[model samples]
Target chain A: MTAVLRRPTAAAPRARGRRRMLPFSPRHIALIPIAFVFAVPLLQMFLAALSPSAELIQYPPPFIPSHLTLSGFQRLFAQSDILRWLGNTVIVSVVAIVSNLVLCSLAGYGFARLRFHGKNFGFFGILATIMIPTQVLMIPTFVMFASVGLTDTLGAAIVPWLASSFGVFLMRQFFLSLPAELEEAGLIDGCNRLQVFWRIVLPLAKPALATLAIFTLLGAWNDLVWPIIAINNPGAFTLQLGMANFQGVRRTDWALLMAGNVVATLPLVLFFVAAQKQFVATMTFSGLKG
Target chain B: MVTHTAVLRGSPSRARARRLGSAKRTVEGWGFVAPATILILGLSIFPAAWAFLLSLEKWNGFSTPTFLGGGNYAEIVGDQQFWDAFGHTALYVVLFVPASVLAGLVLALLLNGRIRFVGVYRTAIFVPFVVSPATTGILTNYLFDQQFGIVNHVLGVVGLPQQGWLTDRHQAMLVIAIMSLWGSAAFTTVIYLAALQDIPAELLEAAAIDGANRWQAFWKVVWPELAAVTVFVTIWQTVQATQLFDLVYTTTRGGPLNATETIVYYLWDTAFHQFQFGYGSAVAYVLFGGTLIVTLIFVLVSRRRSSEVI
Candidate 1:
């Protein structure tokens, strides 16, 4: 067993080095087609957004337009509150990211390092709620919000995004995986727990924090269901809510609908492209251990 | 306890100081957890408990709530619409979970090798997952439109007859399932890819030397390593399938004779649209209970299977 394990470690690097020299691999033939199939929808969305309205409504709609036009984009901007919706979405996402980082890290640190009464019970209680589907909670949550006069406001969207059980669990798991020695040393050096967390531990937790921020941002930015239930006020619509309503109202305007889709999706796609490494890392980490 | 005893052995004053420090530590711990604890309690635990209570009462969001004492749940049992929605959700899970997982596994296996442009391939596969389900739904609607869709155009190009996609009740759910798979298979792909990379190359080489073919080697080696992840993916996918709303809401609105009405969609339509909060709450609890039971069953079965293998 030991020899088998040792052989791989020794052989793996050299094999990789040899494989890198090949100009092309047979795998590309299969991969290229799969990648094209996967990429076509996004490509289509962009193309349709720029396609002429006549071409968009044509039978078996033209794959490529005779000439690209900005009319769809012009109409999207002029006809809807797309800009305000984008602004609201950004505000929601920013607030969610900040609050999740602060609250989840604090709670996670407490669970990971502090010895308090009911520590296990509290942690497990929060973790247990992760199994409860959000669908079950929406009605009562809406009722509660309505009773508080928070319905039809951005608060309904922002309030739930303020903190999450998964955020707390993720932070705690990351904290636990870290070495305790540095923290112990900080305590010995006369720093308070908060100071230690702020000055010493947080700097080390940047990667985990980034992962949390990314997930929170994505969730808040793309949220549609709750916003649909809560916010009917056109002024308070997030990008997704606005887009959904846009589609509903303009069922036949393919160009306008595609334009809205592009605007709503481009930011996230760009973010994913820029931070592809962290994006993949976050997904794998969450999927395997969440 | 050990610290207290140790300090007591050292000096009386030190023992008192240690107790004070521990008390301070406890306070600090509570301070750290208080904000998150309150939020979770208020948002999750309280709402869940409140939903259970509301399930037993009738309220239309404007008037006084009247207690029904399990009447709503009893009604749910006999309600054909609820059962129809349940059946639709079940069908969705059946269509979605296996196909997504299998597609993910295939994509992961393909991408895991010593390949060129691995990063590019990964991004292509993953971009759809990053796109919101609502956007995906809109894209699906246009792409699969009965009269003008690119899908029908492709069928025509291929010398096959064009078919109604989202419009046909027989094919609407299947279209939704395919769209969902397109958007979400990348999640499982990323997961399985991570697991695949962790498997040692020597094991496959050893199996090859032992005269095991690729299929035999995969079944005997790779499959076992992936069993736990498969369970996790299945349960997650099932939960997602049960909560299928955004796509349907965006595209079908449970349309063409209510063929695509899922539990959550039906629940939303009942409460928000029809003002049947009490009935909706009952539907919600049934969904919650069903999800919990299914998750538990998956865990238990996987546990027993793994133990038997051990």
Candidate 2:
């Protein structure tokens, strides 16, 4: 069993070296254009943001800018509430990440380890809610929030994201995959369940927690429709909501719009680049289980 | 919920002590799960139930709601605008799902091999998936702009006549589909790549040794292995396609003549724009019911096929 597992890792580097020595391969021939096509939208967004306002209005604007300018960004900052919107988005995303990590982990650990009656019923019930489309729930949710005076408030945006069924499911899956022995040892050493989870299990669960945090951040940050419905107050707008409204109201201002898109998109792209491995891992995990 | 008295009554003293310990565990378990349970119930399940109740009432956001007794649903059956939006949504699903799934599968197969700059290619392809759909839509509007967009510029450079892109009713939905694919195909690619890596190398090697060519081996082996992932991607994409609000809201606002008015967009227009909350909830239910039926069909069919394969 050990040899079988070890052979693939042992063979990987040598195989990579051999492939590296080949000057060109059919795969490269096929992939180059595909990658370029996939990458053009992002490149376009950045370049267009840098293009001068005068040039953007021209017929068939230059693919590459005449000369880069920060005028669009300057105008964006000067004229809009973009910074305020971005701050609100950050607050929403951070609260979401922290709440999801805490609430989902506690609930997930309980579902994974605790022997409560109706545990199966409760867990599956939560899981089943994943299929209930968010579009259908929005009206009632909006009404409920309005009744509680959450409408048009940042709290409206923050409430729905506090915890997610997917987060709980993810944490539970991660916890289940862990060897229970370490937790059992903690329990034997006179640590209670909560302590065993916090001190031992949570430290080991760093990867899952990171994955959950990244997903939660992405979801909360990019959320558009709910925020638009629930928060019309300009002061409470999240970045995506603000950008959408900006685009609608100022459709003619190409440079400003592009700059706004850049501002909205760049942070996430940079975050993905910084944590590329974790981002990919999160995608793979979600794809497999989703 | 768990009754302590029943456990103690049926047990000896030692057993009673253990039962008490289990009772304590049950309480602790509930304590751990309570927060998430309450939140999910309050925010998701309760709202879903309320949506159903709201569907059967007539209200205009401010006035007292009068019970409609399925009148909203009855109107929906004959509502021409609702049907048009539903048709548009269907068109979007038809256009978006297969194209993205196929493109993703092709890209994944291409990347699955040992190659130079594999990391660069993967990153380039997957970056778009990370961008918000609203931003993608904004970019699409500019890139495909009728007059000054780069897409038309490229067409002009090649001597083809420039066409109105998003501004034209005939072409708007297709443009939306292409933009959506650009943003989403990478997701399916990532999933497919992972599934491809899981195929045992030895199985492919054995097929090669037995004189099967690459294409044959792929069809006879790799293709079958991809069935599950394909189903997942299709269902996910279809669900996403149904909730196609962000893109339309940003770019078209369901127009160049409502050509892109999807069900969700229509529902939003109804409830929020027109303040017809009751009718909008009914529309929401229709969409929910349709999505549920479609998803159930996919799951059931996949289960049967997998069982047959076994």
Candidate 3:
């Protein structure tokens, strides 16, 4: 066994030595063109946002803007209900984030650690629900919401996103991976299940909760289809629905559209930058650990 | 309710106590899931059910739906336009989904190491996922625009003719496909990267010691572990492909003689534009039905595969 282990150990050194054969291996460089292609769209959006009128629409669009301008953004803020849309989006997303953190955690913890009857069965049922396409549910949901007179409210946007099957599943998986000893100790120390969950597991779950929040917020913020279907009133339009109005049937106002894009995209970028490290850490932990 | 609980609890009085406890737990459980469940069921499931009922009717959005029964279904089956849209979607899946899966997998495999700037590469690949698809669609529109787009401009320098990218029926779907790949490949890559990282290093070393080449090791060991990720990506891509509204809506508006018109786009037009709620509901149901069948098939296949593995 020792001899066999020694051969593999020795092989590692040879592999390291062989690494010197290429200055920059071709494989590593293969990602460059693809990454560049991915980055170009974002760059152009930035360029379009900066370029002056007639410049953006000009044939053979300018590769780079001669001078940057914030006119589009200013126009966006000045004309449209951009601020209202932003406020609406923030409200919906914040509600979704908070609710998901609490509700998903409770359900996830229940499924993960608590000894409940039909636990496995319930989980599998939830898992099975994942396969049902959301498309089928949309029309019925609209009718139901309309009956309750909740059709035009932000509540329609906020509520559906809060209880994702995936969020519960993610949290459950994370909870299962955690050592039960800590929670068990808390229990022995006169902590009930709810108390143990509140003080012990909740703090430990910041990363997963954040990841859930990020995804939930992004989903809620960028949602176009539901808002379009649910809200005909301009007062209720989220940023996406509000911005889409720029593409009029006859002619699109590219400047306003570009402005709207910038306004809509900025918050997401800020959120990503602020929580990027935590986001990445959680992604790897939740996705890979499974 | 008390008697029902008593029966379940086995001793009448004990059962009563258990019933109360269980009822409270059930209520709590429902409360936990209430907001989301209610909304989803209302907005999603309820709409779907009403749509299905509407599929059997003939109504404008404003009018009372007249019963059409199976006529709409028959009409959909005979509708050449629906088939054309379906064909476009199939073509899209063929061109875009596989190419994306391969690109994502390759990126994950290439970057699944402690290389210098690996984090940078990973982030660069994933940045697109966070960017709005509508923005990406617009950017791609300009890039691949025939006359003055950067793509044709590049091709022009290469002495190649500028293709009518968004305007040409044949090329329109390709441009949208490319945009779709650009927007979604990042998420797929990240998921694949996660899957790749889960692969044990010892397995690779063991395979290498057994004289398996890098290619052999990847196929035998790495690919199996990635099977789940592959399924996830494929299902996601398929669903996203069928729901190909955003990019198509933004870039082509299902235009250039409806070359890029997907089922969802068609449905949107029927319901929102034409006010043919009943007909649109039929289309929606058909799409839902197709998706359901596909999902069922995938689930069955995966389950069987798992069983076989076990």
Candidate 4:
């Protein structure tokens, strides 16, 4: 994990047409097949979704549909509670991103720069929690949620995610790497601690905040296990649970199910496109890759 | 938190003022950290402590849990289904960790070759990881549908035999593995790519100057530098493989004859579906024990190796 910290700040952009860096390079030829292997399943799913129902049932399931239609999506929204699911998912993700951004950074900045009682032990204790499997936590968490009347509510899903251990660790590390002179200047001006953090530190922490935001949003959006067990009400179900139920009920309907998948996944694709560089940087920097 | 240090280091101040300021920083530090600390300790450690109590009792979720000291653990040892699920998880870890790592390394190496439109290819590969696993399960289910799947269709078109994918109990775990591999390889590739980029060009240059082939250079120059990341990725993958629930939950529900039942899925089944709360907590503890053992062993081995190198 420490190795990831030494990651180069800026990767060298590939120098195209550099007079063949490798001898007898057949890179594209090799890559084309592997990329095709990686891409075709996703493309095939989209094609299946766009195809008419009868066409999808044909043998040798058409890789390229004869005609594209919105019928699959139309059926998904018209027949299932997909829009409700989308709304619930959006609310959950938005709340998660906002709360994590606020809480993790506040705590993270404290741990990073503050000299206080039990600071090292406190931070290390949180870091150690990262190793505990979510599975181990599931049973007791569900029991507690049930006892507290949180089960079957969006709160059950949102609460555990509010301030992830990793989020704090990442923010703390980011803060540590920041130049301290700026904060010292604010301190020298007779500003209180919280004011310095707000006025000087946080504004400078935008890149770290953005990175944390992206990761949290992605996790909350794509989460399944906790939501499935914790939130049983169809009304409270997130997009993943809604999609899972849709598959469970209509596994045979390839077109409609594929459409639901696309509905569930398309936003992530668009989001990734908008934030590719950050995603790449975070993925590289997040030593907790699992 | 940020105030005291700056003030203390500034030009001489009254002892009383400095002491007050120091105390203020301590209060502020606690204020900033308390919320997250309380939340984590409450949600994480608190539940874990209570779970130990739950593990000691035998009860359905509804009725009062009955104390059965040491009984749940005894039952687990004799439970054939538990052993089978444990075996399934072990097999999965053995197959998946290596397959994903290799596939990732191969992809990263290829991308590192600087093919045209590298960003496009990398994004296409990585997009799967961002898609929810439950959704990935559905996509793969549709892709591997027994009769209408694109996989069998392509195989048939290529004049090959079409094989049963998600059906025929034997192939269920394999199908799940393929889906996991697809998503996990994307993550592993990104990690490997970063590690690969960090390897010194001079090392590869040295290897090539010695007339080593690409394969030779990779084995001698690249792999050594990547050993640390490799250990991390393998351990990461192993832990993840053990908790293989989401994809399996949506896809197999632990399967035809329970052939695909991994430990976490079994734990979920026992606790949530069957409502055997005490036994489920017991299983959770066992899963924790297994994970701790694996992690401790890896940590020990890695520490020893690093010590030897130093």
**Full-model lDDT for every candidate:** 0.86, 0.86, 0.71, 0.82
Q: Which stretches of candidate 4 lie over 4 Å from their true place?
A: A1-24, A288-290, B1-19, B302-310
Chain A (alone) TM-scores for all candidate structures: 0.91, 0.91, 0.85, 0.90
The model with the greater DockQ, 3 or 4, is: 4
| Per-residue C-alpha lDDT of model 4 across residues B149-235, encoded as one tens digit per residue | 888888898999988877767888888888889876788898888888777666766666687766776777788788888888888
Model 3 error, position B110 (Å): 1.8
C-alpha-based local distance difference test score of model 2: 0.86
DockQ for model 4?
Answer: 0.49
List runs of model 2 lying over 4 Å from the truth.
A1-23, B1-12, B303-310
Error of 3 at A235 (Å): 2.5
Task: Report model 1's chain A TM-score.
Answer: 0.91
Per-residue lDDT of candidate 3, residues A106-148 (tens digit): 8788877755445566666666556556555555556656767
Q: Candidate 1, what DockQ?
A: 0.50
Candidate 4 residue B56 Cα shift, in angstroms, is: 1.6
Tell me the spans in candidate 3 whose CA falls farther than 4 Å from its real position.
A1-14, A113-125, A151-153, A179-193, A249-256, A277-290, B1-47, B295-310
Candidate 2 chain A minimal-lDDT segment of 10 residues = A2-11
Candidate 1 collision pairs: none
Residue A91 displacement (Å), model 3: 2.1
DockQ for all models, in order? 0.50, 0.52, 0.29, 0.49
**Highest-scoring model, DockQ:** 2
Model 3, B261: alpha-carbon shift in Å?
A: 1.2
lDDT for predicted candidate 1 compared with the true structure: 0.86
Q: What is the TM-score of each predicted model, taking all chains together?
A: 0.93, 0.93, 0.85, 0.92
lDDT of 3 by residue, B223-304 (tens): 8878888887877777768877877776788889988888888887777677777788788888877887887798789979
